[model samples]
Target: MDILQFEKQYLRLPSAIDEIHDELFDQKGIRVFVKRDDLIHPIISGNKWRKLREYIQIAQFNGYKHLISFGGAYSNHLYALAFAAKELGLASTGIIRGDELTSQSNLYLSQMESWGMNLKFISRTNYQKKLIPKEIDTTNSMIIAEGGYGKMAIKGVSYITKEINQGNFEHIICPIGTGTTYLGLCESTNNIEVHGILTLNNLKEIESNALEVGIPIQRIYDAYIFGKYAKQPEELVNFCQLFEQKHQIKIEPIYTGRMFYGLYDLIRKDKFKPESNILALHTGGLKS
Candidate 1:
């Protein structure tokens, strides 16, 4: 599909899915289906699009001319909102973490700015304390919480729950960065087991983020975090390369790759019985 056609259609619908025919999973007595939310749109793909769709609509409908949000250097949230805002003809400003970046810090930031997102750099401490509290100037502006995980996004993320409810899957698994999508999925289900895989070194802080969404964690796998957030150690890189080659599904180290790796680990341990059907969400932050 062309970019414009897909973008316009995605705002009104959920992304498609693909079923992998890997014999390893089949021999292990498990069925794996990937919810390809990553293919929703190139820039505003996956959970980022789900998290930002309604916020952007509310911004425009509420008569706001500008949207201000916070994120790190390669945040998918900022990258998505920048392009979505531009598509909707609304102005956007990204309060980026760290005051150490030049105009050419990286390609993601550069694309954000090129798409009409005004960049504002702040120290990490201030970014955590001030901007995270939504203290940005609000003159005709909508203040988006970090990672676009505020209440506004819960509705969109719940779409996953709705889809999963319609499927025969016994368990749902997703990568947990800030736990927004996990919570959204959790809020709409009662019986299905939801597994969240950590992609950062922070277990306690990640738990807190999950709690902020009011989702009680049962099992969160953190063994595959590699080292820290955004750190692409050799193992993770090599694993992603091999997995993509076999599955033909594109994934990055920061999120989906870790989740898939962790999923295979659990399967190898015989954690799921032959009666179990699993759905892994491709949450999509490869652009980051």
Candidate 2:
């Protein structure tokens, strides 16, 4: 389970931020840049890819035949985990949050099932009450906590800090789901303002958890949630379509699209100085 070897063999991804220049930022009257973690490995890419890499390594090292985790119906983490586990020759299971299975929403879940992932849908109350699935054989199996699984999940986020250090940027903005990526980015760097836009409402618990990990972060904006997790607004849908047309990049309404919308709003509101350098993290859940 040499992670280095795994990285070399399966984690070769492009940097999506390659050609961004001042001209792009000038349109918004602020100096803006992007960190393309989205281009990391196609399957095991983005924050989810980095966060799960070590967990997969540990599971394989421990000779686990199965990997179990949690997420919602359209969870990027679940999607990434299913694909990564299949790629690494391991069994995978997803404990989804809701019981209702809509035809439109079950496409990804069906795909995961096709990839040999066992899908279990639980009630929201039951899902929260049961953080770790009870049926799993913990003796030989590894259960990766959803949303980056604490400090160990920050390995991939450290790469963003390294990239920023190599460039000249004062502030970095990214969407906050479980706050794992935000924690990793903040802990791995200094002198840069880390702004997390909450993708869900009621993130006080996540904030406390991130602070406990000693990650300095500022919650500068929130995605308005639209009601709850995975819920989207017409504005967001329109923005997603417009963004893809302009940038030739597809963004899911769940995370990246919301963050981009927030960023644009912040710039429109004159939240940043025109001369300031800002870097927005494309945390890459676009494939949704």
Candidate 3:
């Protein structure tokens, strides 16, 4: 089956909106809702699929046979790409950071290998430069950047704004990694506020991305990163567990947990106006 057919028959587009009620939101006279992009697919879910959709389409249409991308040992982007390439009848290569790692390093890498993705482990220094293997051929290949960060990714993520009923909400917020999703929302919206909660200390990078896209980097919050990316502090882990118990929805500390924590703190600090309706995106990296 083709990419369009696979998407139509399997992937969930325009993912559902779920209203989450809390006493804190009630006290603030605000309503909080979650854009359930996680429900898009069990594997290629959330912003992963959104960011990769256009890239896959372009590869298929332009007769590219191989899809190459960069990531770490447990990269959600690489996992999604491997599965997508397998399903779409294309080849894939994952240039993984950490020369010590291999297909046996973890279950994710093993799974990617099972999906026929040629995983090449590289040194940290070489990975920083995104150097591909000398033996690997680039002919008829589409190389996607780490975490799917690029103009095509921004274009893919921008569709979220169109999927959402923007008129119903005063603000839309997401976690910023490479800033693709945040920039896309900002580029696509005019009247509604686009807020970004930093999952890592990449504020300057995100600002540069926004500037490149000709969007204002006005509403990015930097106080919530909790030292660095993938830290998984005790408080954050606890919050994620409690949140799942309360809302019956799963969230991971790396991204969604940080975003939700920041959102709650912002509400407690009275950052938003009363009666405001805010939408938080669940960008789905819940592999565990």
What lDDT would each prediction earn against the true structure? 0.81, 0.75, 0.92
lDDT of 3 by residue, 70-112 (tens): 9999999999999999999999999999999989989999999
Clashing pairs in 3: none
Q: Summarize candidate 1's per-residue lDDT along 1-288 as a digit string, tens digits.
A: 332454566553456667777777888978888998887777788898778867876776678889988888988899998998887788899998999985489998888999999888888889878553345456899988888877778777876677655458889899988777877777776677888898887678767766775767766788888878879888888889998999899899889889998998999889888868888999888774
TM per candidate: 0.90, 0.87, 0.98
Ranking by lDDT: 3, 1, 2
lDDT of 3 at 166: 82
| Local lDDT at 278 for model 2 | 83
- What lDDT would candidate 3 get against the real structure? 0.92
Q: Candidate 2 lDDT, tens digit per residue, 42-110?
A: 766678776886787777777888988888887889888999888778898888888775324668888
Root-mean-square deviation of Cα positions for candidate 2 versus the true structure, in angstroms: 2.8
Segments of candidate 1 deviating more than 4 angstroms: 1-12, 132-137, 165-167, 209-213
